[model samples]
Target: MVLPAPRYRKPANDLRPALPPAQRSGYTSALASPGPFTEMEKLLAVTAIGPDRAGLVRDLSEVVTRSGCSIHESRMMALGSEFAMLMLVGGNWHAIGKLRERAAELQEATGLTITLRDASARPKVDAVPYLVDVVTLDHEGIVLGLSEFFASRGLEIAEMSTRRYNAPHTGAIMFSVQMTVNVPASVHMASLREEFFAYCDAENLDAVLEPAQR
Candidate 1:
């Protein structure tokens, strides 16, 4: 007896036609398929915090590198006994997926809290840069008072570092603040200086304000 003709089965790939040239999503490399990177159009802001220990940076960085992404910028520091790190990572789609998938693994291995988010391009600010230095007998309200002083003037504090120490000869406690502030170019420098010093005098503190070198 003649056997019935075997039924034909279409291959899986044959069912889906190639993406049309114009209809294809721009995110994909070509009209054919997706890969690690099609356009490299995203930036990821990654933040992590963990107990300070040796090889923490190495471990985190290895994850980024092994996944074929680069750490464009990173800031790592020991805050008290804990370590904090912030990194700006750039990668294509697949690379980003790898980073996300492996984040949990990293957490388990290193015990760090890691977060990832999309980041926009940095905007430019035209405000003039200035350095403000203050030194006085250590006391309460120094930082609050200074912060209020700048806020009143609508100045932006880009960065500030404060320290307390004993005076070299007298052994008296001293506090100092060094801050980088952005002042609008429209402000009159001479008059502003006069006004700032007047406030410092009233606060019983010494201050010096001047342009910051690039």
Candidate 2:
């Protein structure tokens, strides 16, 4: 049986400090600057979520640069109809109000739901045990198929990676995913293996699940 993602999440107890009011102007100025963020610099976290489509990244990049911010750490995921981006940007403008206005403008232009907030709002995620790796050729229904597999078995994915393969001859697209999952003591490892392989066979994708040696 297949199920939707279980809303699996990290513990909420972990906390991060809020961005200081004094850092706003400096952030704005740095974004206006024409360079990458230095070690000593700070960044504003900008997020955008909506239907996945063309030019989402390009449009956001242009809007952010125009507002004087430089993207540093970026994480993006496209799940069917939804697309999400988390960008750590370094700049001198810290006025969230201005950032909010700019995000509104981008939304008007792209029909995207955009948000600008201090990254500190999200809680920190502590390290955990158990990792899952899955490698496969690129195709539709990949993420959802595997996500369902994890959820059905009560596993939570902490992080995952997927990309297209660039082999000169084969030129096959691939997805390499590494995730951390919670294992209940009662679950049988062999049964989980059977389930994983069964799904992989049906989907015509190569997948492997094992205890992380590290």
Candidate 3:
């Protein structure tokens, strides 16, 4: 089964455990503690989701602000009755420490499920870009099939979104997807498109693959 990831994931590199309440309550002497790291900085990516309500943005903003972190980038949207957010926070060691220590408080106070993970740095991706558009009758496994097809060919999906809606004239339910995939330079473009068509044909999917516009 394909399940959504949980909130608050520690990376393999993070070896420390959450501090106990007693340790959390006491700040190791400020005089000895090195404050917000000025020279060394890192990003922590946060994902939050909950029932839609007023002041959602404000509450999340307050959490980040209080933690002494800066919002580097974020996106929030209502998905049906649920509100989802993904944000990148940047700060020095001390600030990130404060964030980790207090994030659970925000989650409890706001009734939102929050998850965090360190985003060390994004490695540059060098590959040819291709855009794929697919439309078909709404049905389960469409996404899984598409993803598996790409994976079989060693393709990397950079961005993808799928939506279900009624057809314009017939009003029949339909699923549509627009995605960007990165093909390694070693792969042949013509043959890849042929393989995509073959898979779509077997799956009764309507699809088009083309070079992505710069």
Task: Point out where model 2 deviates above 4 Å.
Answer: 1-42, 94-97, 120-131, 134-158, 161-177, 180-214
Candidate maximizing TM-score = 3
Model 3 clash pairs? 7-115, 8-115, 8-116
Ranking of predictions according to lDDT: 3, 1, 2
User: Candidate 2: how many backbone clashes?
Assistant: 16
- lDDT per residue (tens digit) for residues 119-156 in model 2: 53223223223445455556788888888888876676
TM-score for every candidate vs. truth?
0.68, 0.42, 0.73
Superior by TM-score: candidate 1 or candidate 3: 3
In model 3, state the lDDT of residue 42: 74
lDDT of 3 at 120: 56
1-214: candidate 1 lDDT, tens digit per residue: 1122222222222322232343222211111112232254567889999999999899899999888778876667788899998887888879888988787799988889999998754545555666676777789999999899889988877666677766665676778776777767677666667777787889877666766554
Clashes of each: 0, 16, 3
lDDT of 2: 0.58
Q: Which wins on TM-score, candidate 1 or candidate 2? A: 1
lDDT values for all models: 0.69, 0.58, 0.71
- Structural RMSD, model 3: 16.0
